[model samples]
Target: MPSSRISEEITFRKLEALLAFMETGNLAKAAEALEVSTVSVHRALHSLEEGMRCALFRHEGRNLLPTEAAHVLADVARDVLKSMAEGIRETREAAGYSADQLKIGSLYSLTIRTVPQVVIGIKTRRPDLQAELVLGSNADLLYKLKQGAIDAALTGMPEPDPEIESIPLFEDDIFFAAPADSRFARMEAIDLRLCRDEPFVSLGEGFVTSSGFMEAFRIADFTPNIVMKVGDIFSLMNLVGGGIGYTLLPGRVRDMAAGNIALIPLTAEFDMKQTIGLSFLRRRERDPNLLALAAVCRMTRIAR
Candidate 1:
């Protein structure tokens, strides 16, 4: 494949005209949006097509229909423009050009339970620290932390990496949750063998909780017959609420009970608990802001 021409060598003014043309679908509207004459917009797009050596649009009445090449180029151009806007925003934020804000990332499961508590605790301890919370999956949060998009994050025990360091905050055990009217709900403690034949609802493979639950089941020497594989704790709990199937969820869920699902402790061969912790890049250890955030994480715990 041939290397593309340098962005500087190509005129961004023509690219902007093409983007405006795509959005408005008509020369008059495109010219209005670009704040230029209809003749100017037409000339810019014609010149852009000349540079690219392709027909970008087809004329039908007053409307212009994008060709396949135009469609593909428009997608890339949209992303490029969006990223440029984001870069400008982030640069402004980092240059002390706006109100200072601390970015934080946390797992979706903890967004309702552990995260709010930590935010309140941070405010009480450091009233001046302006904070912005970003909720994502463990992998997504880890990626953000590594990229310096987030100063610190709260998640379950993430697999170790040389650049990342995890500090233990709390241990959260898994328990069986079932509808109050279900047969399993009557039991205070559930045996793994007894639940082997029961219908199971659980998180799928992408989540940390599901990964741990699968390993625990294997270690306990039982293959669970999962009837439904959901994405988040809320949906899994809802499935349990409707008595779809019993599910194993982290003890942190005790903090946010939305339904009449019985929480049963498990005394099986393998003990399952997700070690909730704070993760940050090892290089950021000495940073004062991150250090203070780490201290705040240590003081916060799952509500009993």
Candidate 2:
């Protein structure tokens, strides 16, 4: 089809409904947000299909899901929408309003160290802008990013998500931490296999740290004896310090002096290093706050 024909056929209302469906992942919710009845939302979506000359939603029971075509067009819609938002924000800036506030999310371990340092630097450079930091497990953070709930995030590389463009910031080595009175405390670098039988405390399952720790052990051909599970890095360290069990933690935990705890490097002949980075939707790359955040991250060093 010609570009002129496509443009003439497309209506803003239909595009809005399509994007809302993509965001809500359901017709009823999208309808509520659009302040229209479910039937109206459904009609708009069906008309959108006719205009595009392609099927958008794949019907499965009561649910309408994005087909491959819908997935492709959804990206285009997001780009269009983001451009519109940027235009509006530029207008607001020109009218003497501060730049739109940036919402950032962080993994728990980073909340204790890296994120604060970066936020301090960010505020110093752009004192007029507002910044909010949210802390959660990597899974939760990534979910919020997909939903447009946050502007950007500092997290361990969760996985290769095509929607998210990641800037590599640092590589954090996982070390076994234990209290001085514990059996594994005096070790310099221990083989991961030797520690498989040792009771360990670790981050909860949804956390990236837990995933990385398990992946390291799986590659080394063993399952860990995880004795306890905790949500944050500080608690994991405190547990290890109190001799609950050994735990795998990043180098940042070393910043504090805990009397009985030691961080022992792993001697496994595999990549046990956790890659830490900032991530944002690829479509949001041009947003001023996101671009500025990426710039700040670029100035920092990544541990090898």
TM-score of each: 0.63, 0.65
Q: Quote the positional error of residue 166 for candidate 1 in Å.
A: 1.5
Q: How many residue pairs clash in each candidate at the backbone level?
A: 0, 1
Off by over 4 Å in 1: 1-99, 301-304
lDDT of 2 at 188: 68
**How well is each residue in 52-145 modelled by candidate 1, as lDDT tens digits?**
7788878888767889888777788788878888898787667322325678888778887678778887777677888898877677788888
Backbone clashes in model 1, listed as residue pairs:
none
What's the C-alpha lDDT at position 235 in model 1?
87
Q: What is the lDDT of every predicted structure here?
A: 0.78, 0.79
Number of the predicted model whose TM-score against the real structure is largest: 2
Off by over 4 Å in 2: 1-87, 90-99, 302-304
Best by lDDT: 2
RMSD of candidate 1 to true structure, Å: 16.3
Supply the TM-score for candidate 2. Answer: 0.65
